[model samples]
Target chain A: MEPFIRLTAVAAPLLTPNINTDVLIRVEPMIKVPKGKLGPYCFEAWRYLPDRSENPDFILNKPAYRSAKILLAGLNFGCGSSREPAVWALADMGFRCIIAPGFGDIFFNNCFQSGMLPIVMPVETVEKLAKLAQSQGDLAPDFTVDLERQVIVTPSGEDIAFRIDALKRRALLDGLDDIGVTLAAKAKIDAFQANDLAQRPWIYRY
Target chain B: MAASTLFEKIWTSHVISDLGDGFALLHVDRHILHDLNAMKSLVELRERGYAVRNPELTIATPDHGVSTLPGRNIDTVPEGAALLRGYLEETRRAGIRSFDMNEDGQGIVHVIGPELGLTQPGTLFVCGDSHTCTHGGLGALGFGTGRSEVIHVLATQSIYQKKPKQMRINFNGTPGKGVTAKDLILYLIGQIGADGGNGHAVEYAGSAINAMSVEGRLTICNLSIEFGAKVGMIGPDDTAYDYLHGRRFSPAGANWDRAIAHWKTLPTDAGAKFDREIDVNVANVGPQITWGTSPQHVISVNDVVPDPATAGDAARRDAMNGALDYMGLTPGQPIAGTPIDWVFIGSCTNSRISDLREAGAIARGRKVKPGVSAWVVPGSQQVKQQAEAEGLHEVFKQAGFEWREPGCSMCLAANGELMPRGQRSVSTTNRNFEGRQGPGARTHLASPSMAAAAAIEGAITDVRKMMV
Candidate 1:
């Protein structure tokens, strides 16, 4: 969409694994869309996202290091519940890259659709990347992920090989997502809908 | 040949088209929304100037952010309160039936549907909440949805979905004295692992299911998502009909007769086939809790967590080690008496009036431990009101518990009440994954009575003795 969504940044270490979408983003925040407003609430809110007028201490506001485009996470990231707002929050917040050892079944799909590259690596690789990112803020711990090479290169010239499903790899490389996939089958879908409705009039009356 | 199961009958019956690759254009009959997802759909409606295709088909309620602390009816939580108020105003303006906290008609969306008899046999019920499957206890097809699908349903009253395969989970034999429906479902999760139902719609049947009460069936179906099912159901029966007999929105005198007649024929045929069938012995299940992240990483309170070396599968061992490290629990240690600092017994999953009553029975004359902080919250203002009328509030308050108003409190701490970072809690809510309660808060999922007993003991303890 943006000529290739590449997020070069210092890694923000998120040690927690199996983070549900609700934790990474939030349902209450996604519902209050005034248009592309989720970037602020990506990790915000201890309670519900406070009224835009009221200031609240959100999780993303902690004083350690802020505004990370690259998130280095522990194994089994984005697990537990299947709330999708987490993906929206991260993508909307300009975080286009996430490196983790594993992802939940549903959250993984949700992330791919939003153009967030969820790179799978060994747990030790993620741990090493997290350590590199935490120590060097604004140091630009370079992770230039070359799809052709299928490797993410670090600032220190270390190469991290990543794995992605062949189908998902094509979807990402071609930028063909859910909407594109659905629209590609539009003709077939229309004919099927017509025929099925003709056959089952009672079910398709609506 | 594979035989068509009850799920196949209902699912295929509703299909308008096969979109290929397991996707289908099935029809949704009744669409429901809560405060959050409803508003997103409303904005989309105003943008396209689309009038709802069928207003009567949609139901809206303020459950997720509805205030639970009684008398403090004022909006306290910022975004949730204002958003809920906006949902009430807009839905009322649109001529849609909207339930607020003050409405005796209001409660958790799933709790209200069956109680009011709006959830009926052979219907397609969809909401924006995961536990929408709770309605399937009455032979309806119910499940959660995404924001985009919510928008589609809001505009056209129809949404496209993939048809899931069928699975029938049958529990036979008499449950022991301490065993409840929650125990059965938890034990099932432990057996099947988290992704077990990833592509199935489960139908719970057999003798043990027949013995479960309406409330118990709701609890069972409520956790179907934990096993990865798109939906879960129990065929409508006398128990479901009886529970729905005289609620505010239930079918009245004449409609009741018609409803019952229709519900009577909704059961599966003797030869109905399932894509998969699993059997459980109700007698073997006991009070269960998660010692690790995945619900499958569970054990009986009296048993120790299995060592990784003893794990049968590589994935199980990996999950076991991961959960143990995150939860700070060691392998082979007794989970019972693993001291907890807090106990919270309320959520959409188990915050109904019946759950409160069960906890009340357990808490009668028992003082909570001196250091433990515990609270009992109803699912809805109506549940709160009913509990008060039944003197269940006194039962909770007399047991050194805080009787709080109902919204999803501490369930995710989205309401401002937290279990503090790194503290452990015995909760009646679903999921025990890390930071599910707070940044580092540890959660132990349990039945409401078990939660009450843990609150009293300040640790994991068997709930059977407190039953009497």
Candidate 2:
């Protein structure tokens, strides 16, 4: 996992609410495509036309947003399915941060696991940023997401505060392997299990 | 301790250590896996030189990627063969129990867990599939994990989780006849948007929930993820106890008595406070169905499609218009009587023996309408055997509905059993996302009986009309 500190890049605006994981990466490629090679399959339904050509109408396909690393979306982004590959697909497609009004709980957690940042702002705030990105097009100023400071520097040079779980922020900043950290407390876990077994033997008997 | 909700009790009992900032290292009591990511996680664990911490507590099956076609094998779906084979090999290598293809206990992970008594009250269950919340019907704390979390659980048998806020939704009245649990949940999602339950652990309560069968409760909990809640549960009662009394993995003899005593104490105490509360009176909700893409885009069968022009905001109007266009629906047209090309009567949400029987009751002496291709895929091999033993298969077969093997067939179409592009289907699945059945294939989410009625009429017909 790559450590996320600060990133400055163009932001693509896709303001549709309830953009689910199934739409991020469909089931077929999700099963067959291996990790890190899913860039082409990310958002296959909306990214491509009926004939498999790039859908120029899609914001990501537009020349100005082709190299975007930030995504601005609407409510309930990444809802449906616990597929982690949806985050992988977005990462593969070069997106490192997603800004939305809200997110599905599992998807929100999955983002932290993948070293990607999911920022929640007020719906009106996101819409305002999206409008700025859209109205400026090719000349849209690059936005900067500074994780250590917990703020998003908008194109207009305004700093917007955000919040993330402290432990999650620390994990992302250090790119720490969570399992290794948890395994360090094996003694504690073992002790808990031993005590629990005495209290509830039926749990272990099964 | 003052008062505690069932969620708090279960969560506190499973806590290994508090990592602070509302996070805790949770001890996973039961870890379930399926074909999609379990084998890959196990193989990765091996590559990392880690062994499964508690293989005895882990169970696996091949459901997500296997074909449901008759005479199916690992190779039945060519893309899924490698996954099925890897699952068998890895589980065997890791000393984990796996209910393989055609095995008596093999079926969808959520269905088989409770059916085989692997799910119990007061236990914390985790799985790689989101619908693992279905086990919450047994009064367990169940939620889905991502692939990395699966590997973490395999290595440590513990996971880091931030405790969620609690929300108790009370269904205060009895549902009208023909309005099933599926309709109740769909109505809840429709009333509150898709993200209504976001960031909360939901508890279903009140008279309506207490009166439902265990299978109906499972159906209600199975779609919790669809409504943006990762954890949903119902407190266990005599119905749950009776359902698990003699199952394969359930405790017997003295253990059963002790287990019941512990489970009896797992319900919420009087005066327990919740972060939020929602009261629903289900006395008038009809058999609900999705008219457009999202689960929130649902209405009673008697209602007409909503016009995007009435939407409060531009973005919402655009989304509604896009959904209507993809679904091939007119704004003012009735959702009922909309022609459908296919009917799929199975999925994790509604594929138990009871669900099959409901569909069978509607199909007993009727024929599927011409030009409609209908299929009934059971949730598990046990469900299939039980349905067959009860002659439900004959009822469906005689009505021109295919009686296929057990797997998640036509629900997300992972097994290559998808409806063709441009066709519309009435599915007993949890989702109606655009192209969920197939690319350009529209879906109307409904219950098994509703899907069966659509199969007979070749359109979205109100199940109540046939119920009378």
Candidate 3:
């Protein structure tokens, strides 16, 4: 995983709420491919026509947003299913930051594990950014996300401050996954287990 | 201190270390995994040189990627077979208990957890799949986690977490006749859009929930993920205890007494406070169904399809328009009698014996309408066997429905069973997202009985009208 301090990229707006993981990445029958190969299949159902042709109407198919590295999504983005492939697909597709009103809990955690930064801002701010992206028409301008400063800089120099967990910010900056985070408290865990064993032997019987 | 919410009582008790800023290193009582993500996660653990701290507390099963075709061998579904083989191999190497695809106890992780008595009251459980909230029906604090967290739980038997705000949703009054638990939940999601419960653990209380059977409670809890809740639970009562008294994995004798004593204390106290409270009166909630691409885009079976022109905002209007286009529905058209190509009555949400029985009763003397295909995929082998022994399968087969094996089939469309592109279906599954069943496959989420009634009518017909 790569540490994320700051990222500047064109923002693609998916203005729909509850864009679930199942849509972000189709539930794959063949999940055995290399991690990097998932980018092509991101949003497969919406990205492609029935005849296997690209759906040109999709935002990602537009010439300007084709290289987008930031996603300005609506409330409750990545809301259903716990597939980590959703994060893998987004990250593998070159998205570095996702700005939304909120996110599904598991998907938010998966983003950190995959080196993607998820920033939660007020819904009004996200709507403003989304409107700005729309006004750009075919040539969406790049936005800058600064994790250390907890702010998003719009094309017009408007700064949108976002709130993220301090611990999550540290994880993103350090590129530390949950394993690394949990293992940091290993000594405390062991001591708690010893105390639990002495006090509640029957609890572990099952 | 004032009385604590049921969520705080169970969650705070499991905290081994409190990290600053509302986060904690909480102990996990049981961890469950399934085929889709388990194989890769187990391999990662092995490569990290971290042995599973306690294999006894972990269990894996083949559910997501297996065929629901009767007498089907793993080779029948090649991709599914490969995934199952990987899970089998990895579980063996990791020394974790795995319920093989052919085993009687093997089923969807959520179904098997309760059937095998692994999901006891007041415990913390995590799974790789989002619907792990299904176990919260047992009064447990259960939620989904990511792959890294699953591996972390495997290595240390604990996962880093933050306590979620607690909310309570009370369904008062008796639900009208022919209204199932699925209808109640769908109605709730419709009332409060899909993300209504975001960032909160919800407790389902009131007379309505107390009157439900355990299977009914499970059905309600299974859809908690759809509402964006971290977890949804019903406090354990005699209904729960009676259901678990002599199950295959339940405690016996004096141990049972001790367990019951603790379980009795799992409910909210008289003065417990919740961050949010919602009261729903079920006096008029008809057999509910989704009419659009999202689960929250719901209406009663008798209500007409919503006109996008009535939407309060441009975004909502656009969403409704897109859904109408994808669903091939017209504005102001009645939702009833909307033609459907398939009927699916399975998934963790509604595949238990009681669900099957409801579907079976609806299909008992009626044949499926022409051009409509119906399938009943049981939640587990035990559900399948019980349905067969009770002649439910014979009834379904006689009514032009296929009685399939146990696994998540059309629910995800990941397995071979899928509704064709451009086809419309009435499903008992939790999700109705665009292309959820398959690319361009339109879905109407409903109860099992409703699915059965649709199969017989070849359209989204009202189950209440069909009840005899």
Candidate 4:
């Protein structure tokens, strides 16, 4: 996991809400491909035609947005499926930030583990960002997502506030995944397990 | 102290450390893994040099990425062999208990955990698959995790987490004829929309829930992730206890008594406050069929397709229009007569023995419509054998429905069992997300009996009309 304090990059607009994990990373059965090799398959069903040619209409396929590092999306982004490849694909595509009205519960949690910033902004703020991206059309616009400040700075100099808990904020700044956090609490966890084993021995009988 | 919701009660007892800001280090009582997605996490763990903290607490099976064909080996499908071999190798290396293909206990992760008694009341469980919430039918705090979190759990036997707010959905009336727990959940998702349960753990309650069988409860809780909830549960009761009494992994003798005593206290306290509440009357919730892309786009089987112009907002209208365009349906058309090219009767959602019996009853003496493909993939090896022993397989076979071995077959289309492009299907699976069943596949999510009813008539037929 990489530390994500701040990122200023082109933001691709995918206005459709409920953009699910299956769309984010199409599941290919029998393909033993690793997660790092999944970027090309991100949104494969939607991003490409049956002939294996890129769908010219998809925003990510356009020349200006091809290198987008931020994704500005609509409500309920990353819904459906617990596949972490959805997060992996976005990170592999160099997207460090995802701004949306909200995100699916598991997807939101998965982002922190991968050091991707999933920012939840007000619907009005998201709509505003969407409008900005749309107005730019094929020309991708740059946005600044500052995790330290907990704000998204639009291209037009507006600072939109977003809320993230102090714990997640620290995790992002420190590039700490869940394992790192758990390892840090090693003493406490060991103590709890010792106490729990004494109290509930049957649970460990497996 | 205030009365605690069922979620808070279960969550509080598992907290190992309070990280503040609502986050905690929560212990996981059980962790489940499957062949399709577990290898990546295992590889990462190996790279990190972390041995599993307690291999005894974890279980692995080949479910999501294996062929469900009878006598199917990894070579049955191009990728099937490698996926199965990987599962066997990784589980062997990690020392975690695994049920390989053709094994006695091999099944969908969600189905096997409860059937084997690994999912008990008041404990927290996590799995790589989203439908793990099915365990919550027994009052466990079961939910899905991504590959990275799976690695963390294998390493520490716990997960870093923030507690979710709680939601309680109570259904008061008895279901009418032909309605099942699948219908109840589809109706709820349609009522609340796909994102309505976001950020909350939902506990199903009221009279309607209490009357349901454990299998039905599992069906309802299985779709919790479809509506954005991470955890969905039903408080354990005598029904749940009866279901778990003699399962292979269940406690015996005095241990059983102690387990029962603890589980009896797992329900929500009286006057408990939930972050949100919704109440619906199930008497009017007839069989539900999703008419559009998302599960929220569902309507009663007897209702007409919705017009995009009638949507609440522009975004919703666009969503409806896109769905209509993709699904090839017309506004104000009756959903009952909408043609379906395929009917699928299995998934973690509705693939238990009772679910199979319902489908079998409908398929008996009825021929499948010409050019319509119908298939029944049982949820587990146990379900498959039981259905076969009971002659349910013959009923389906006689009715022109293909009876396949259990796993997540048509539900994901990851194995070679996808519906043809532009073909609309009435499926017993959870999500109907575009291309969910396969590329260009149009799916209408429904109950098992409803799917069978469609198979017999070649279109989306009202299951109530077929009911005797």
Candidate 5:
């Protein structure tokens, strides 16, 4: 996993509510496409037309937003399925941050593992950012998300505060492997298991 | 100590250490895997030089990637053959029990867990699929985890989780005639938008929930993820105990008596407080179905497509318009009588023996309408055997419905069984997201009997009309 510190890039605005994981990457490509190779298949349904040509109407397909690294979205973004490939697809496509009113719980957690930041902002605030991004098109000023400072620097030079779980923020900053950290507490886990076995014998017997 | 809710009690008991900031390292009692995710974790563990911490507590099956065709083999779905083979070999190498496609215990992970007694009250269960919450119907704390978390569990048998707030939804009255658990849950999802239960662990209570069969409770809990709750559970009672008695992995002899005593103390105590509460009168909710891309775009069968012009806000209106265009639906048109080309009567939500029986009752004397391809894929091999012995298969077969083997067929379309593009289907599956069944395959979610009725009429028909 890449360590996330600070990033400055163009932001694409897709204001549709309830953009589920299914929309991020369909099931066929999710199963068949290997990791790091999912960039071409991201949002396949909306990204491509019936004849396999790029859908010109999609926000990401527009020339102004083709190189965007940030997504400004509406409520309940990534709301369906626990498929982690959805996050992989977005990361593969060069997306490093997403600003939405809310997010599905599992998808929210999956983002940190892939070095992608999911920020929950007020609906009004997100809509305001999206409006600004849309109004400027290719000339839209690049937005900066700084993890250490825990703020998003908007195109208008205003700093918007955000909060992430302290442990998660640290993990992302350092690109720490979680399993190695947990395995360091082997003694504590073994002790807990030994004590628990006596109280719930049936759990082990099964 | 103060009184505790069912979720509180289960969560407290499973905690190994508090990592602070509302996060804790939890001891997982059971870990179930399927072909879709097991191989990834196993390969990662091998690469990292870590053995499975507790192979005895882990079990696997090939469900999502295998075909449901009669006498199906790993190669039946050629695209998924490598995954199925890798899953079996890895589980065998790790000394974990794995049920193959032809095995008696093999089925959808959620279905077989409860059927084989691997799920029990007061246990914390984790799986790779979101519908793992189905085990919570048996009074367990079940939730889905991602691939990295799967590897974490394999190596340490523990997961770090931020405790979720508690919410209880009470179904206070009896369901009306022909209204099933599927309808009750769908109605709730419609009431509370798709993300209403986000970040909360939900508990189902009151008279309606208490009166439901265990299978019905499973159906209700299976869709918790669809509504944005990772965990959904019910307090175990005599119904759950009766259902688990004498099953394969259930406690026996003296262990049964002790296990029951512990489980009896697991329900919420009087005066326990929840962060939020919602009460519903099940008597008023009719058969429900989705009309759009998301699960929350639902209404009773008697209602019509809502006009986007009348929506409360511009965002919602745009969403409604997009859904209408994709579904090829006209505003103000009745949801009922919408033409459907396929009827899928199986999924983790509604593919149990009871679900099959309900669909069989509707299909017994009616033939599927011409040009509509209908299929009844059982939840598990055991469910299939039980349905076959009860002659449900014959009824479906006689009614022109294909009675297929057990797997997660067409639910996620992982096994290559999918409805063609530009078609519509009435599916018993939980999700109705865009392209869920296939590209351009519009789906309307409903109960098994409702799906069966749609097959017979070649359109979306109210199941109540054919209940008798």
Candidate 6:
């Protein structure tokens, strides 16, 4: 999981701004009990009406979004409660990259840790991309995010740059988290601990 | 250089090591627990056949899943009650101090912790519940944690974590009449858009914060997490010391002298740098309400629901439209005059004695409106007892509001009680999310007095008129 690393070919873009974790996955789908069955319920509630009728109005119900892995959304895409279930539901639903202008802090952290990429583009750009994808009909809409370049290459061959923290980007590229990074430096930490414990006897017990 | 605000003093005392990249391994002094999240860890421990290593460092209470309706044993619901009972049973088995159902000490963990002195200044507090930041109102460093961290804290009494950067939020200008700590927080959350405090500990200073009583400060600090803040604190002054002087666990005599002297040194230094700082002009704040699924979707009572075209960003605009659609609210209507079917005044957020007194003051002689049901629930047993002694319950009953026992009643509909579907309520609780108060039960966040005024008018009414 390199920061902004991972390039994939996408079909028509799906745009939904501020899609709460709730929409990413319904509560029932995540009820993540029964061990690991988190994927199928991604849009359970939205897909069906109260009478279990198929909801034709839902985004996933549309042909374009059904296979669109590249979600181009507006600003503050995930600004709400810190429910990690939303992220799990999104990842399980086959969305790898959520391109938006902003996201809630907790939701953002959850996205990175779960191997999902949240690419933030300005509002003007997201609006342009969304309208283009919406009107393109059968046109193949896609973008490539080169972690090495920190740039998103649109289907029109235009490159859009984004910003990411250097260290987090490194960790994502290396498939590492805070704990993973810490463990990588275990030997150094161990040696430092041995020396520090002798100097500050009360601080180190384990 | 050592201190300029109560926040700096607490941070310095707890800073074990400054790990690189804006993180610290601060010492944790107290860890609190409740039913919903502890179950996750209990399930794991039961699978591995592990025992808790330290019980003295932990505390448990059953507030989230219990029925607030009196005389109904929690066992009525086999699974939910069993899970709650299991939490209490395990806490007892582990020799952890528990404020369980049928125990006088039983109450919301945040409420009782302060009253009983389990929460104190310059200590770190962690809980499985996000609102645990409510403890920070007492000048302690409190935050919520995940299940894995819960296990770590139970096993070693200390969990590994890096510290967050600090922020100072100054509430300048005077809070207009009827503005409260609850309203201040709701307005602040609205301004920050729910995630503005990400990766930071916010400390409130300025005239408005200084004017708030200890209890008022507690209410303001409790909702820090709603804005993604890890900690929210206010400087400990005479007001703080006065609140803690003789609590059940507060240091005695000689130790008290030492503690007070140390507490006096709590405050941010004049030149200390913060990761971020926000200044809210309290003068502009007014009666606030939640119009959407998040606390950030708030506006002053006089303001109208925002049209998507006028929203700050496309995402925000879309969210506003979605919120309006789900809430059945018109875009340009005044929030102040919206009709309400119920008024709820309780929850970990604003269910203290002061909260009740304010509500009771509004309900003193007025009866609830026809077709409207209102509730006046204190946050803890002690709060209830204090309110009862002051005859606040009589005022509520006289005003046609239900006087319920202490429990997390109606805050979440986990208890058998609920607001009927499609009924709108003015609630003093923290959340207005879909079904947070009850399934399809609309909730608008407001101060206790405002809740009382709504109970009387059966609509969202301004409390300034009702204020004595």
* Most accurate candidate by DockQ: 2
List TM-score per model, in order.
Answer: 0.79, 0.99, 0.97, 0.97, 0.99, 0.84
DockQ of each: 0.11, 0.81, 0.65, 0.71, 0.80, 0.17
**Candidate 2's TM-score:** 0.99
Candidate 1 lDDT over B40-137, as tens digits, reads 66766667566665566678877666555666563766656777777877787667777666676677788778766677777778876677888888
Q: Model 6 chain B — which ten-residue stretch has the worst lDDT?
A: B155-164
lDDT of 3 by residue, B32-109 (tens): 889887888888888887778878778888888889888987887886787788888988887888888889888888
Residue runs of model 5 more than 4 Å from their true location after superposition: A135-137
- In candidate 6, residue A107 scores what lDDT? 64
Which pairs of residues collide in candidate 3? none
For candidate 3, please provide the TM-score of chain A on its own: 0.92
Give me the displacement of residue B82 in model 6, in angstroms. Answer: 3.3
Q: Candidates sorted by DockQ, descending order?
A: 2, 5, 4, 3, 6, 1
- Looking at model 4, the pairs that clash are A30-B79, B74-B81
Per-model CA lDDT versus the true structure:
0.72, 0.92, 0.87, 0.87, 0.92, 0.72
Q: What is the Å distance of residue A14 in model 3 from its true position?
A: 1.7
What tier of docking accuracy does candidate 5 attain?
high
Where's the lowest-lDDT run of ten residues in candidate 5 chain B? B70-79
lDDT for each residue of candidate 5 in B330-440, tens digit (9 for 90 to 100)? 999999999999999998999999999999999998999999999999999999999999999999999999999989989889889998898999999999888999898
lDDT of 6 at A44: 59
How well does model 5 score by local distance difference test? 0.92
Q: Cα lDDT for residue B464, model 5?
A: 95
Error of 1 at A64 (Å): 20
Which portions of model 1 miss their true places by more than 4 Å?
A: A1-19, A26-82, A93-206, B1-3, B308-322
Candidate 1 local accuracy as lDDT?
0.72
**Where in model 4 is the C-alpha error above 4 Å?**
A29-31, A135-138
